[model samples]
Every structure is written in C-alpha cells, then in structure tokens.
Target: MSNLIDMCNCCNGCSSRRQGYTLKLSFPKKLLVATSVLVILAMVVMPSEARALQHKIRHERRQHDAVALTKDARIRQEELRRRPHRRPALLPQTKDPAERLRNLEAERFKNATRTIQKKLKNTRRYFNEERKVLNETREYRDGMPAWLPTINFVAIHFHTYKKQGATLSERKFAYVIPKLHKSLKEFLEIFDRLYKVEVDFADDPFSNYNRTRHELIWNTTRRLYSTIAEIEENMAAVNVPEQNFTPSKSLQALEMKVDAPQCLKNDYIAFRAYGNLLNNWFSEFKCPHGKKVTTKNAKCAAYEAKLIEKKNKRNKNTER
Candidate 1:
C-alpha cells in the first residue's frame, strides 16, 4: 500500500505537477463559476408552486393593462362625442313658400348640372391621363424586378379594380334601380331629398309648374332605367380579356425573405405601378351606349345655363 501511494516514479514522476495544474481558478473567477452553477441549478430545480405564483402575477398584470386600455378608449370616445361635426348647407332657409319654391328649382338645376359636368370630366380624364399612364407602365412592366414589391402591388390593383366593379354592380342593382322607379311616393321622396322642397297645401300637383316638374322626373327616371338595363345586357354579352401584366412568383417569395429597407423599396415600386394601371383601365372604358344614356342632354343643359344666369343676376342685384 505504501509503494502504491508513492508510485510517481512508475508514472514518469509528473503526476504531482499535473494535479497542481488541473483547472486552477482565481478568487473572482471561482466566484463567477459558482454563481453560474447555482443559477443553472435553481432554474432546473425550481418548485411548481413558485412557477404558478409567478404566472398568476403576470396574468393579473395583463388583466390590469387590458382594463386600463378599455378605460382610455372610453374616455377618448366620450371626448369625440362632445364635439359635433358641422354639415354643409343644402338649401336656403326661407319662410315664404314662393321664394322657397324658386330657390329649390334653382338648386335642382344647379345640382343636376354639376353632377353631369363632374361625370363628363371624370370620363375624359380616364381616357386622356389614365390611358397614357397605363400604356407607359407596360414599357416598365417586363423590365421590373420579379421579386420586387411592384409585382404584389400590381396584383393588388388588379384585385381592387375587380372588387370595385363588383361593388358598383351591386350598388346599381340594390339601391339605384329601386330608387329610380317613378311611383308617386318615391318621386315625392326623391324630389324632397334632392331639392330640399316640402310639398304643402299651396303646391297643387295638377298645377302647371308641379305637373311639368313631375313629368320631367318621370322621363328622367325612365331614361335612367333604360340606360342601366342596356349596360347590364352589354356586360353580359361582352367578355373582357384577362390582364396581360402580372408579377412573377419567384420574386414574391424572395420578398418574404428580405429585410425592412429592401421591403419598403419594393412596396413603393408596386404602389406606383398599381396606381398607373388603375388609371389606364378606367380610361379605356367608354360610357356604355354613349351620350344618350348619359345625364347631359339639350334640355337639361339649357335649363342649367338659364339657372346659372338667374343666379348671377340675383347676386348682382344683391351687390347693387
């Protein structure tokens, strides 16, 4: 046993030196290693009750946060309610029936004329400005990066236009068609809404003025119905070709893997392309069945011009 304890000679007499060199740590290093070991041990051996208590505390904090957020939202909503929005003046405030009637007539002409002119302007712009941009965009479409945000934006524009077209079709079918029917009840309601005129004892339906206006509305309603019917028939008959331009799939996948700055740059490219495409599509479409189906006609135009002249005269008289 004594020989075994002193067997350094058999092991080349270096065993003692090796033991001394084995993982010698300084005081601070020893403290750091001990702390790390204790931390790991604590994490591994923590009690379930302690963990449940911690979870309960965190859940209570989240509930408190949610309650605070809801309260803040209610306060903000109440503040908003205190401030009412102002509406635009739709008609002149008058006591005399004759003056009110005259003003209503003037307003009818003005509103109708304005509506017609706006429609015409929008139509013209689509053809000139919108068409130009779309044709130009085709030049860049093939050259654009496949993985670019522009591709997605173009896709979005295509889908948006389709959705808008569908919505317009629904609106026409659901609301415009029913409202445009010229029954006596609907006629009165529509006229009241549009002209801000109330029908009272003084206004006889059989009187020349009332009779003429009623006939005009009826004629206009019939024309609108015919136009809408024609549009539906034409749409059913004509099949639009599929859009030629679209983004490549490979680029769209690459976009998912990229960082923020690259993503933003791609997004801008897509948005610009989409905007141009929308304008182009809208421009090419001719108002179905031409000007006859449109609001602008000889009688309405003349009446509109006459109303404008009368308005100018009244303003001048007030100035004098």
Candidate 2:
C-alpha cells in the first residue's frame, strides 16, 4: 500500500494538501512523519485479530481446567460408588447376629492379611506399633491377685514371643481372654456387692464412701471387666463366653479353680495365666505363714512391732 503512493501524491508544505484537493496540500514535516507512523501501526494492530487471540487463549484455559477437574471429580465419585466386598464361599454367613459380625470381621481380617502378606517384611513397623497399642490398652485383671499393680503390670509386660507360641490372631485373644475373665467376673460381683453393702453402712449414712480415689480406681478393674463383657455382648457383637463362676459339668473342660483357698475362691473360674502380679500376690500374702490375726490365739506383740517396722522401712525406700 505504501509502495503505491506516487511522487505526484507526495505533498510539499502547500502542495494540494487540502481535504479533497490535489493542490494546496500543507502539512508540517513532523506531523506528516507522525501520520505515516500511525498508518503503519493501524495496519499492524487489527482489533478483531487481537480480540480473537485473547478469546482463543481463554477457551483453551477453560478446557484444560475442566479436564483436570473432571478427572478429579470422576475419581471421587467412583470412590463413593464403590461397594463393600463379600467374603469367600468357604466361610458361610450365620443366621445369628454375633456369628454374622464374626463372618464380616473374618472377611475384613482376610483382606488385611492379604494386604499384609503383599507388604511382606515391609510392614514390621506397623505391626509392632499396633501390638503395643493392643497390649497396653486391652489389658485386663481381677482384684488382689491380678489387680496388684506390680505383679499384673509385670505380667502384662512379659511379651509373648514367636517361640512362646502366642500370636495377635483373633483366635488367640478370644481363646485366652475368657478364662482370664472368670476370675474377673467373680471379683467384680464380689466388689460390687461389697460396695453396695458398705455404702449402706458408711460412717455417716449421707457421707461419700471412705475409699480414696486411687483405691476406688484400683478396685474398679473388676467392674471394668464386667462392663467390658457386657459391652462386647451388646455393642461390639462379640460372643461373650458363658458367665460361669460356679462349676457346671458341661463347661468343666474350661474351668480351672482353687489351687488355694478353696472356701474363698470361685468354683467354675478359670483365671488368667499366672501373670507376674497375680503370682507374686498369691505367693507373698496368701500363704499359710501370712496368717491374719486370730481372735482366739494372736501373734506376739514383738512380732507385730517387727512387721510394722519392716513395712514402714519398705514404704520409705519405695518413696525415695
């Protein structure tokens, strides 16, 4: 277009510079240069072209974002729509609620086992962590023998190694715990009955129990066991072993009773394996030598003084 401008069309200061005339044209050299630059810029800057480029950029951006968002949304929606899997055919579903729960739990366990097997030796850390939580939080005990802090805590601390043939399988937990719970139930019934009896005969009828908070806590392990059993039976869908503190011929295979104190001990009870605390409690205090004061024939006053001195010294050393 510039090349087409002829020498005749080129304007002198007053050479036909009027609007529509070929003669008398007049423009300053500076103004003419500016006008020429404006013409070149106008040719380069078509408004419709710039507008189309911006619109195209915006459209492409929207498409890219929509693809990413659609992918993420699809993944989430798929997750929500996923169904829980059923168990294998070998493990039949029982009509009982407890058995049904057990079946579902077995499936869950199988899935976990499969996943863990896939992880191979890589899941040792996770396994160890879970073991710690289970042992710590799931510990149970009865009063006196099992409830003595030192013995029971040590017993719990005794970890069952692979060589010991103890595993964290459900069968192991279910198998061993019910026996432990019998003594627990007996203790609980005794304590609850004791508390009820004592509360009625308090020093003041309206007064709170004379027991210390720690004492109450110490005694409450039995109650906790009872409550846990009830909760398992009702809420956790766990089948609680039949409550048996008295001997029944049918469940005799499960009952292990009274190595000592046949009169005081519950009959149909199978207590916890001789855990450290329980063993120590029975050994130290339940012996024939560990006699209570006899109303008819008492120990010597000198023996009492010596025992009191020993007890005080032990207490002092323990505090330190």
Candidate 3:
C-alpha cells in the first residue's frame, strides 16, 4: 500500500510539472509571441516600410460627394419642382390669410391703377360714352314708367336666363356646411350662456366690414401682384399703354378666383354673413308683399292651379 501511495504521489508530481511546463512557463513567451505576431500583422496592414502604392486602375469612375445627399444640393428637374422656386424641404408651412390678403391688395391696387391708366390713355372717348350711357340707363330704369316695372322685369329676365334650372343660381349650401355647423355650434354655446349673463362681450357683425375699396375687394385676384405691378409700372413709366394690359378676358374681369379650399373657407363665412345681410336688407324695405291679384307671367302657374281646383270640384260633383 505504501508502494502504491508513493507511485501515486510521483504521478501527481509529474502531471503538475507537465501542466506548469505547458501553461505557466510558456505563458510569458506565448504572450511575447502573440504580441510580436500582432505587431507583425499591424506592420503588414500599414506596410510603412513597403513601397508607395501606384494609382489603382479602376474600371469606371464617377465623382461623388457626401454633401450631395443634402436636399438643396440637388437640382430640381420638372419632376421634382413643386412650387415657383427651390426652397428648403424642412420649412414649416404658413397659410396666414391676413398676410396673403395684404399682398393680394397691393397687387390688386397696382393692377387696377395700371388698368385705369391704360383705359385713360387708349379709349378715353369710349369710356366716357359708356359711363354716360350707364347713367342714362340707371335713370330710365329708376322711373316706374306707365309701361312696365323695370326692376322686376329685369330681375325676371335675368332669372329666366337660368335654363339650367336653379342649379347655377343656387350657391351651394353644402360647400359652406362645415362653416355653418361651426357657427351653429358657436351660436348654441352663446345661446346657452346668454341667460347666465356670464360674458361681457356682445356679437357685432358690422365691425368686421371692410370699407368699400376696389383694391381690397380685388386683391386676391392672383399671385405676387407686386411682381406684375412692377412690370406694369415700368411699362407705364415708358408710356407703353399697350403693354399695360394683357389681351386675356380673365385679365379684364379682374377676377379673384380664390383657391377651392380657400374659397370654401371664405364663401362659408360670406354665406353666413350675406344671409344675415340679405335678411336685414329685405326687412328694412317693408315691401315685396301683397300679390292679391296675380301678375302677368307667373299668372299661368296660378291659372293651372285654379284649373286643377275646378276639375277636382267637378269630379266631386259628378261622384255625388
């Protein structure tokens, strides 16, 4: 048993020595070897001692820039062009109507002034004649002659022009429905609070009226009026009457065709206000009542209704 134990101890000592030789003794050298290997690898990568590299013969080449990736660094073709000019993509959009209105007014005034100046130059005689003719027509129409009621006749005539039915004359209520609803919602809130006497403010519509100015009314006619006005003013400065105006019918009308979405907003407000205005106007007149005897043209509708009434009576008589 002692001999076996001695042999085991010897084997254990030999194993420990082998482990030390393989692991601990070689550890420092191994570390040194690894470091040297890393240094050699690093040297190979940079190759500072190696010869300078010749120009690489690439198959194809194209110039590129990291800056070209930015939005403005790009050229806008017809496909990419959205508006009048190139602008930063990240800008917050602005849609202030007041700002737009001011710009519109300036443009409109310049345009109208240019037009009047042009008319003053070109067709002075004709403009004078037309103004006189309009005045005479107004005078003639104002008098209720023994012959006819002019205003009613003219209104009827104008109304008769709608062969397309009432569709064209009917300003679409649906278009301004959103605004109407908004106003109605507001009105309901006001009504509920009116009895409580909580708020000091009272609603006043007339305070918002713009003075009857041609420029203010016409300003929203088109884009960047000052740009056009600048051109017009320059032409006028050079005594170029012909250059003062364009030949387009649209240009003559001084139309302020608002954007559909924008028009919806404006017309919605217009509809509400105009509805009130019309009511007030009509109420003040204290007229447009009493048709005891039917008038000339619409008497046909009444006659037809009367005939239907008589026919119903005759049928009842016969049945009885």
Clash pairs detected, candidate 3: none
Per-residue lDDT tens digits for candidate 1, residues 1-320, read 35435645655543654676332432465888999999988887677668888999999999999998899899988777665233323566899998787666544433333333344344334333422322122333333554333212222212222244233333223322222122212222332222222233433322444344344444434543443344333323332121222333443233333433343344334434434433422321222112342236554344334445666776799899
Candidate that scores best on TM-score: 2
| TM-scores, each model vs. reference | 0.18, 0.28, 0.15
lDDT of 2: 0.40
List runs of model 1 lying over 4 Å from the truth. Answer: 1-143, 147-254, 286-320
Ranking by lDDT: 1, 2, 3
Report the C-alpha displacement of residue 275, candidate 1, in angstroms. 0.4
**Candidate 3 lDDT, 1-320, residue by residue in tens:** 45433444663454445555333433575889999999989888766434333222221221233445543546555436755235323333349876565555344444443443343233223322322221122222222112110112112211223233222212221112122223223322322222222212323321122121112223211211333344345444433342122132322222244333332233233323323322322221212113333234354334435445666776799899
Tens digit of lDDT per residue, candidate 2, span 120-238? 22222232332232112112333333321121322222224343332243443343344434544544444343233222233441232233322442335433454445423432343
Model 3 lowest lDDT segment of ten: 145-154
Return whichever of 1 and 3 wins on TM-score. Answer: 1
Whole-model Cα lDDT per candidate? 0.41, 0.40, 0.33
Candidate 2 Cα errors over 4 Å, as ranges: 1-174, 199-227, 230-243, 247-320
Q: Candidate 1, TM-score vs. the true structure?
A: 0.18
Better of 1 and 3 by lDDT: 1
